[model samples]
Target: MEGFLIRAVVVGIGLWLASQIVPGVEFRSTESLIAAALLLGIVNAFVRPVLIILTLPIALVTLGFFLLVINGLMIELVAWFLKGFVVAGFWPAFFAAIVVGLTSWVMSGWIGGPPKGRIDVVTMRQTGPGRWE
Candidate 1:
């Protein structure tokens, strides 16, 4: 779908930004960066939820902070599987994940997807209990 490709491109940009900003995160080329983004998306979609459930107790104990560790680990896992992507250590992955998440959040706004920027608007409606009309 068009939406999916847009999200992937946004994620690729995020990965590129992460590689630039995080000292120990590296992508061999633009192709690798895009592939890393796709791999990250697949890992997040398929593996992250299982990992979260397995680590639920730790997540609860840490007030959800453990999720950040999980995110970094996912990035490391992707780097492990992808030859051209390299993450030097946990800290680098952690920082890179944060940058990637931030970039994705910002870019999602322009992409018109579920993660788009939120705006609240108030409207007046004629009284018809529990109805807009």
Candidate 2:
């Protein structure tokens, strides 16, 4: 999907920034960097949602701040599966996750207004004298 690839590239940019700024996170090669980007996107897409649902109560209790932990966990999980992609500890992952998440969000917003690549629109029709649809 075009959306998927676009997301991956955005995340790859974040990953590159994380590698430079986050001390404990590193990519031994460009291949590893790219692969980690793709894997991170996959983990966030599939695994993060289930984790969020399971931790919904805590997330609500924390006023949504706990989602940062979920984001960190997703980064760590990606690191677990990918060689050369290292998250030294929970803190490092947590901060790097913040960087990655913010980077992706800002980049996506700049690329278009949203990640979907299209703006939303609505149409209104008059069905009757005083009714609308």
Please provide, for model 2 over 47-105, each residue's C-alpha lDDT reduced to its tens digit, 9 standing for 90 to 100: 99999999999999999999999998988998899988888999989988889889988
How accurate locally is residue 133 in candidate 1, as Cα lDDT from 0 to 100? 46
Poorest lDDT segment (10 consecutive residues) of candidate 2: 111-120
Tell me the number of clashing residue pairs for each predicted model. Answer: 0, 0
Best of the candidates, TM-score: 2
lDDT, candidates in the order shown: 0.88, 0.89
CA-only RMSD, every prediction: 4.5, 3.3
**How many clashing pairs does model 2 include?**
0
How well does each candidate superpose onto the true structure, as a TM-score? 0.80, 0.85
Model 2's lDDT to the true fold? 0.89
Judging by lDDT against the true structure, name the best candidate: 2
TM-score of 2: 0.85
